[model samples]
Target: DPRSRDENGLAPIVWKREKMIPYVPTPIVYGGYLFDWSDEGIVNCVDLKTGKDVWVKRLSEGGKYSGSLLCIDGKIYGVEEGGTVTVIEAGPEFKELGTADLGDASYSTPAVANGRLYLRTFSRLKCLPAKKS
Candidate 1:
């Protein structure tokens, strides 16, 4: 509800993804849902208004996480600390488009603007052309 805000003047956590312990990824909100994940790579999509999960899935082989999730157009992009980027469709059903290997540890989230992707690793920054639908 717009009428509610936390001490920092941000909206409260409308939905909490279950079993996301130790480390929680920064969630991306779009399409009336919030997408987040656990440090172990369990991704959850929940209703925007209610805290009900639409679906949940594990990505990658499971490891530590430092980067948050990103949403562009209608796809979700996530980077694991060990350095693989996972792309999935943002919708009621779960669908992974593809993944890109960073070849090293990455702690920053991918920046998406103007249909391009900017990914950063410990030593390099890469720019990828806009993905084709």
Candidate 2:
């Protein structure tokens, strides 16, 4: 199993000239690109068919990022363990859109329903306005 940790530790499988490993969270595919993030605040975008990295970027103020990634209307959102949500544009190049502070630590992935965003933090659950597209 991917999560099993015992005699065998984590290892990176070679992909082209780079070492690649499965992300802790399921990656999302959009516009022929795959987007995923790591707990170390590193985000990567790879070509959906070639398994080749298009771009890799790290969020500022590095910290634990446990929340699963969310993609909506061409933007990808990654939540840090400290409750800060970072939004980035989904494409070949990396472009950080913005970030929001939920005011509490969050490990659960944010959800969307009926045009609103829902987030569960350590201390609270919040519903915020999400742009309709």
Candidate 3:
């Protein structure tokens, strides 16, 4: 698998220079999975150790994915260009929990503080409280 290689082996697998990822958003690693967002608006979940693709899901409308991923309480978040935030369960299966829109444009990652999620768009900012179980 792609995850069990040496440091030098990571170069060719972890990142494919030949392909165009197109986005600069940071990726998150947790629970043995690496969550990444591509400029094509695709959310990719890969095995952290082997670099194998566990699953892939398109976040929203295609293009302009600049939000970093956030994982909290076994859930993950992906923000799309049009301010639509997608919440998903953190697992090997592609399960989207929900989606909420904030504005017309969102290029930054959502922030979590004091159990609240802070989202920003080209025109506004919103804070959503964490849902109680």
**Number of the top-ranking candidate, with TM-score as the measure:** 2
lDDT of 1: 0.81
Runs of candidate 3 with Cα error greater than 4 angstroms are 1-22, 60-63
The regions of model 1 sitting more than 4 angstroms off are 4-24
Worst 10 residues of 3 by lDDT: 11-20
lDDT of 2 by residue, 11-49 (tens): 444334335443465678899988878778888898866
Give candidate 2 misplaced runs (Cα > 4 Å): 1-23
Error of model 3, residue 54, in angstroms: 1.3
Find the number of clashing residue pairs for candidate 3.
Answer: 3
lDDT of 1 at 75: 83
Mind giving the per-residue lDDT tens digits that candidate 1 earns over 2-116?
A: 7798889988765554565436567878889878767778878888878788998887556667888888879888888989988889998988788878998998888977778
Q: Give the total clashing residue pairs for model 1.
A: 0
Question: If both were scored by lDDT, which would come out higher, candidate 2 or candidate 3?
Answer: 2
RMSD of 2: 7.1
Per lDDT, what order, best first? 1, 2, 3
lDDT of 3 by residue, 1-133 (tens): 4448676665345543234344587877778887777777777888876666888777645556778878888898878887777788888888888887675788888889998888888888888786664
lDDT of each: 0.81, 0.80, 0.76
